[model samples]
Target: MKVHFIAIGGSAMHNLAIALHNKGFEITGSDDEIFEPSKSRLEKYGILPKEWGWYPEKLDTSFDAIILGMHARIDNPELLKAQELGLKIYSYPEYIYEQTKDKTRIVIGGSHGKTTTTSMVMHALKDNNIEFDYMVGAQIEGFETMVKLSQESKIAIFEGDEYLSSPIDRRPKFHLYHPHIALITGIAWDHINVFPTFENYLNQFEIFTQMIQENGSLIYFDEDEHIAKIIKNKREDIEYIPYHSHPFKIVDNCSILKTNKGEIPLEIFGEHNLQNLMGAFHICRKIGLSDESFYQSIQYFSGAAKRLQKLADKNSCTVFQDFAHSPSKLKATTEAVKKQFTNRKLIACMELHTFSSLKKEFLPHYKNTMGSADEAIVYFNPKTIEHKKLEPITKIQVAEAFGGNNVTVYTDSDQVITDLLEHDFNHTNVLLMSSGNFSGLNLIELAEKIVNKY
Candidate 1:
């Protein structure tokens, strides 16, 4: 297969390009800009574009398919050329569906825990020697690429993102993947830029549930009221399996699952994570994995990258960085760290990076989300807001939105670092939560400096 990618520098796009390249497909891609990791990874695969900008002259009917990424604008020249030629053009998710149509698709979808839940299922499948094609959002421990495609694998597991598939394709990414076994971890109103309203944001999941293949299974988290309501009215042809947080107890800072086999200790913790684990368990069971195998494999699962990932620890002070920008994720992550280290003071810092998080109307959703932290800090780069063309937001407005006297807001990344450094690190755990890099601050280095200070 010969495939050309437009805006191939995207995280998922580059990974898919590599996966297809490894499968011996002739891959070519173009992007206006390419950043680290994606740039280097693509170069290593010998599939990096010869130049940065799009070249419409390169587009022709010879290519098997043109995969489009969200980064590409609707007016992208290459996309126009593909359309002009009447060539097959696939949105990232659409192409994935086309490739995995023959396999049993297991899609994990929700506003939160999608990556972690998908990672858990992947780890379990691999540990049990189950060969499966998969596409997860995060770079997991055992996986070389976030996406892997093989003709031999009978199952395809996808981390079902609810975001728009492409600029031209308005459908949510998960909607394209009609999964035979689907799971919705939970839903909290997000992606306000696209959906605009809470009800509209929620309707995507409802559509996702309806998109499941006939007689397929719908696994969901029963604890979430919204998810529970969505599952209340279900199709009799589809199997509905509900899961709650797995029965577990925290023993000396470690969470051990109370399973029928025995008390199985896990490397990862948190109520949300336990719930994700339970969701993964049901998915694995449906895919023919034994309970014993799932338990044994899950014990080795630490977590997906940046999903409450521990960066550094020293002198009773630990530092963690999480990819949590949404209100529900921020709250759950902050509470998890605080719960895990009850003896320590929890200092939680998060960046209002996403379009939703930065919007004035959406800020109020974050009310009391960081209340679990002894000290809460919110950072937002004014330049970022301007770049995104969002309405200006002040530190006071952010503070008021969070509704906490303990919350401190910072506009400067350096100020945040300075403020954090000023604090004594003893008996304190620092949790840096954001979907961004805190405006270019190297978190690993920051974590090391904070840990070494103790």
Candidate 2:
């Protein structure tokens, strides 16, 4: 297949490009600005555009399909050219659906925990010797590429995102999956710029439910009130399986699972992760995996990358970095880390980097979210808001929103780093949480310093 990607340097876009290139498709992509990892990965594939920026002259009827990325604007020159030529254009999600339409698609969708849940399911399947194509949001441990498509695999698992599919396709990416088996972890209002209100954000999931294939199954978290309502009102044709947090006993800083087959120890912890584990277990059940196999395989499952990933550890000091910017993720991650290190001083640092996190209205949802952390630190770059064309937010607003005397807020990146460096690290566990890089901070170096420094 001949495919062209517009604004393809995005993290997801570049990964998809590399996946397709590996699959023996003729791939070409263009972007005005490409950062590390994406730029290097694309270059490694030899499909990286020689020069950045859209080439209207390159778009023609000869291409089999044009894939659109979220980074591309509606007025992008290549997109306009493709439209002018009356060539078929597919949003990244739409194209993925087109490619995997014939397979038994299993889509994992939620306001949070989608990546971790999907990764867990993938790990279980892999360890059980299941062969399948998949797309997960995070760079997992065993998986080299985030996107994988094959003609031989009869099933495809996707980490379904609720965000907009593309600049042209305003629909949530998960809406296009039409999964034979689907999982919804929870419903939390996010993407304020697109959905505007909580109800509006929720309606997308309602629509997603209707899109499930006839006789398909939906595995959802029973603890989520909003999801419970949606599952209750759904048509009886689709099977609804609700799962709660796994029965587990936490003793001696380890989380042990209480299963029908007896106790099974796990590497990951927290009620939220236990909840996600149950959701993944149900999905595995529908796919023909036995309870015993699931448990045996899951014991080896660490976690998805950056979803409370451990960066450094010593006798009394440990550091965790997570890709958790949303309020739901923030609450879950903080609670998880605090629960794990009940005796240690928890220094939780999070960056308000996403569009939703930076919004004024969305700030209120974070109230008391970081209460579990002993020392909560929030960071945001004012220049980021300006670059994204968002309204500016102050440190006081962030501190007040968190509603904790323990919470400290900083706008200056250097000060945040400096404060962390100066803080006593003997018995403290630092949790750095953000979807962004904290304005290009080297997490590994910082983590090593925090763990070894006195």
Candidate 3:
């Protein structure tokens, strides 16, 4: 297979490029700008573009397919060349479908927990000696790349993102993957820039469920009210399996899952994690994994990168870093850490980085979301709002929106780092949550400083 990628330096695009390269396909990709990790990883595979900018002269009819990324504009030179030549083009998920169409596809989608749930299934399957192609949003410990594809594998697992696909293809990504097995962990309002409203955001999931292949199964979190409402319009052509949080107890700060045969100790702790685990378990079972094997493999699963990642533990203080910017994600991460470490002073710091979180209209959804944290610190760069071209907001509005006098807001990055380091972290636990780095704050370094490691 010969594939050319436009805007290939994207998180998903680069991984797919690497995966295809590994599959022995001739791969070539172009991007105007490529950052660390993506640039380095592509270079290691010997497929990194020598020139950064897209060139129309790089294209021809010899290419079997053109994969477009969301980062690329509709007028991208390479994309225009591909279209001019009338070559087939695929969005990230669209190409994934073309590659895995013959295989059983399991897509996990939700506003939250999809990455963790998808990672859990991938780790368990690989741990049990199962060969499978998979794609997840976050990196997993045992996996070398975020996207993997193989001819020998009979199943493919994907983290189904609801965000728009290519700039040209406005459809949500998950809509393209017609999954034989689909699981939605839960739903909450997010991506207000594209989705505009809760109903509009929700309609995408409804369309995704409807896109399931005939005789496919829909595994969902029954506890979510939005999901509950969706399942009301159930289909007879597919089987529906609803799951809730698996029975677990916090033991010695470790999460333990209760099973009929025995209790399994887990490295991950959180109610949302427990629910994610259950969602993964159901997907595993459908693929013929025994309950015993599932629990055994899952016991060793640490977590997907940046999802409740432990950064420091010393002097009776623990620091957790998570990719949680949405209100639901923020609420869940804060609650989980506080519940598990009830004795400690829970200081939660979050960055209002995403377009949704920075918007004035979306602020109210965050009301009381961080109440579990003993100290709630919110950070946002005013310039970020300007960059997004949004209406300017105030620290007062942010503080009030959180519905707490405890909620403190900051516009400066260094001040946040300074205050966190200055505070006495002894017998305290800190949760740093955001999709973006707190305006280039090195969180790992920050965590180490909190524990006196640096």
Candidate 4:
């Protein structure tokens, strides 16, 4: 199989290109810009283009398929050439579906916890020596690539994303998988540039639920009212399994689970994580993992990348960085850190980088989300807003919308870095949350700085 990728340097796209390359398929890709990690990884695979930028001349009738990334626009020359040739073009999700159509697809979808839940399932499966093809959103500790596709594996696990599939495909990526076993973690309105309204954003999930294979299973978080409503409307033939936070007890900053094989300690904690674990448990059970196997395997699970990931710790201070830009994710991450270290002060800072978070109308969803932090800080880049072609917003508006006197807002990246450096790190746990780099503030450096100050 020969696959040509447009905008191949994307996190997911590059991973998929590598996965296919490793499968002994001929892989070629082009992008105008390629960044670190993706560029290096692609180069290591010997598949990185000699030069960046699209070349329509590279498009040929001999190619098997063209997988398009969201980073590629509709007018991309390669895309236009592929269309002109009437060649097969697949969005990331569409191609994934085409590849895994014969397998029992298990898709984990929701506004939050998708990566963590997908990681939990993958951890359990891999630990138990279960062979499976998978695609997760983050670079997990043990996995070489974020995507792994094999002809031998009977099942495919996908971290279902609600974001648009591609420039040509307006549908959400999750809508294409149509999983045989699906899970919805929770719902919060996001992607304002696409959906525009909360109800429209939610309807995508509803559509996803409707797309589930007949007589298949739907595992959901019963605690979420929106998810409950979706599950309630499902067909009777489909199995509906709802899970809550897995039974666990915290002792001396350690989280132990009440398993069938007695109590077991876990490397990861947090109510949301426990909830994600429970959801993963149900999905794994349906897919043939025994309770004993799941429990034993989940013990070594570190967690997905950037979901409360421990960066640096020293002298009672721990620093974490999370990809928690949404309101629900922010609240959950803040609460998780606080709950885990009740004795220490929790200082949380998050960047408003996404389209929804920066939108004036969507700001209300963040009300009280960051209130759990002892000192909550919100940062927004005016340049980022301008770059995204969004309306200008003020720090005062953000602080007001979040509805907390304790909240500190900043627009300058250097100010945030300086403030973080000056803040008392002794006996405090720090969490830096954002989907972005906090406007180019280096997390590892910041984390080291925080840890060293203690």
Candidate 5:
């Protein structure tokens, strides 16, 4: 199959391109600019575009399909050309559905925890010698690529993102993957630019539950009031299984899961992670994995990348970096670290990077979210607001929004780093959280410097 990709330098798009290429399909892709990792990986497959930017001449009717990325604009030249030629075109998720239509599709969806939960299922499946096609949002350990497709696999697991599929496709990516089995980790208001209101943001999931294939099952976190309310009147044809945090205890900063076989120690921790573990448990059981097998396999699972990933550790001082920008994620991650290291001082730092977190109106949602930290720091770049075309927000506004005397807001990345450097790393656990890199701050290097200081 000849598949052409527009704006293929995206994290997910490039991974999909590589997956299709590895499957022995003819792959061609272009982007205005390609960054490291994506650029090198695409080149390694010998499918990297010779030149950057869209080429109208490159669009041909002979191409079997055109996969569009969210990075592409609605008026992308190649997209317009493809539309003009009347060729088959699909958003990323739409194409994924087409590929897995015959397979048992299992989709994990929510504002948060979807990636980690999906990774857990993938880890278990692989460990138990199950062959399956899968697509997860993050680069997981033991997985060559985030997007994997195999002709032999009878099942497909997908990390269901609620974002728009592509520039031209307004449908949520998860909605297109009409799953035979589904999991909703939890619902939290996000993507303020798209959905606007909390109710509007929530209705998407309500629609998603209804889209599940007839006689399919929905495994959801019952603790979330919004999720509970939505599923209360769910489709009678579909089965609903509610889950909560698995039975676990923190011992010497290690989280141990209580299973039927025995107490299994976990590499991942927190109430949110325990909740995710339960969701993964139910999904794995539906996929024919026994409880014992799932528990055994999950013991080796560390975590999905950037979900409270340990960056550097020295003595009692450990540094963690998490992709947590949303209010709920920030709270959960902060509390998780604090709960784990109960006796240690916690320094929770987060970057206000995403569209939702940068918005002045959305700031109040973060009220007291970082209260678990002994010292809380919030960082935002004013220039980033201008680049996103968002209204400028002040450090004072951020401090007030977070509404805590311990919260210290910074507009400069250098200053934040400087302040962090000055702190003594005796028994303090530092948690750096953000969806972005704090305006191009190299976190790994920063973590090294912090760790070396001790």
Candidate 6:
């Protein structure tokens, strides 16, 4: 198989390219510019393009398929050439579906916890000697790449995303997967840039439930009201399984998950993670894993990258980081840390990074989401707003949207770091949340400074 990628430097695209390349397939890709990690990884595979610009003349009838990335525009020269030549063109999700059509697809979908839940399932499967083709949104601890494809694997696990698939594909990425075993962890309105309204956003998951293969299982979190409503109109052909926070009790900073066999201590804590773990447990059961087997493997699973990942700890304070910028994710992350460390002060910081989070209209959804934090700080770069062609918003707007006296807004990330440096964090837990870089702020370095400063 020969696959040509239009925007090969993307986090997902590059991994898929490499996965296919490692399968002994001919892989070629082009990107106008490539950044670190993706650039280095692609070069390591010897598949990096020699030149920058797209050359339509290089594409011929001999190419097997063209996988398009979201980074590419609709009028991309290579895409146009592929269309002109009548070559098979696929969005990332569409191609993944095409490749895994013969396998039992276990798709994890939700506004939050998708990466962590998918990672949990992947970790368990691998630990149990289960060979599976998988695609997750984040890099995990034991996985070499975010995507894995193999001819021998009988199952394919995908972190189903609700965002648009590609520049020309208006449908949500999850809509294309058509999973045999589908799990909706929970739904909170997200990707406002695409869906635009809560009802419209809610409808996508409804459609997703409808798309589940006949007689397949639908696993979900029972506590979420949105998920409850979706299940009310459940399909008749599929079995429905609902789970809660996995019966975990926090004893002296450690989490103990109560199981039918015995109590299993967890390396990970927090309510959201427990909920994610429960959702993953139900999915594993549907895929032929016993409760005891799942528990044994999951005990060794730490977490996905940037999903409440521990960064530094010293002088009785621990600093953590997360890929949480959406309103639901931000609230859950802040609340989870605060709830776990009840005695300690929780200094929760997040950046308005995505198009949805930066929008003035969407800001109000974050109201009281950070209320659990002892000190809440928000940051947004004005230049980012301008670059995204969004309306200018003030610090007052951000503060007012958060709705608390504890909330402090900063346009500059340096100010946030400086303020945090001078603050006393003894017996305090810090949670840094963002889908971005915090305006070039190196969070890992900041975490080291925070813990070692004293």
Best-performing candidate as measured by lDDT? 1
lDDT values for all models: 0.94, 0.90, 0.93, 0.91, 0.93, 0.92
Measure candidate 3: CA RMSD.
1.0
How much is the lDDT of residue 231 in candidate 1? 74
TM-scores, one per candidate: 0.99, 0.98, 0.99, 0.98, 0.99, 0.98
Give, for candidate 1, the lowest lDDT window spanning 10 residues.
225-234
Error of 4 at 381 (Å): 0.7
**lDDT of candidate 6 over 230-289, digit per residue (tens):** 779768899998888888898888889998889999989888999999998888888888
Clashes of each: 0, 0, 0, 0, 0, 0
* Residue pairs with clashing backbones, model 6: none
Give the per-residue lDDT of model 2 (tens digit) for 27-130: 99899989888888888889888997879998778899999999889999899999999989998889889989899999999999999999999999999899
Per-residue accuracy of model 1 over 188-218 as CA lDDT, tens digit each: 9999999998889888999999999999999
Tens digit per residue, CA lDDT, model 4, 152-228:
99999999999999999999999999899999999988888888877888889989999899999888898898877
| Inter-residue clash pairs, candidate 5 | none
Candidate 6 is scored at a TM of: 0.98
Measured with C-alpha atoms, the lDDT of residue 421 in candidate 5 is: 95
Candidate 3: stretches off by over 4 Å? none
Distance from true location, Cα of 101 in model 1, Å? 1.0
List the lowest-lDDT window of 10 residues for candidate 6. 227-236
**Predicted candidate 2: what Cα RMSD to the true structure?**
1.2
2 against 6, candidate with superior lDDT: 6
Give the per-residue lDDT digits (tens) of candidate 5, residues 347-416.
9999999899999999999999999999999999999899999999988899999997999999989999
Q: Cα deviation of 309 in candidate 6 (Å)? A: 0.5
Angstrom error at residue 262, model 5: 1.4
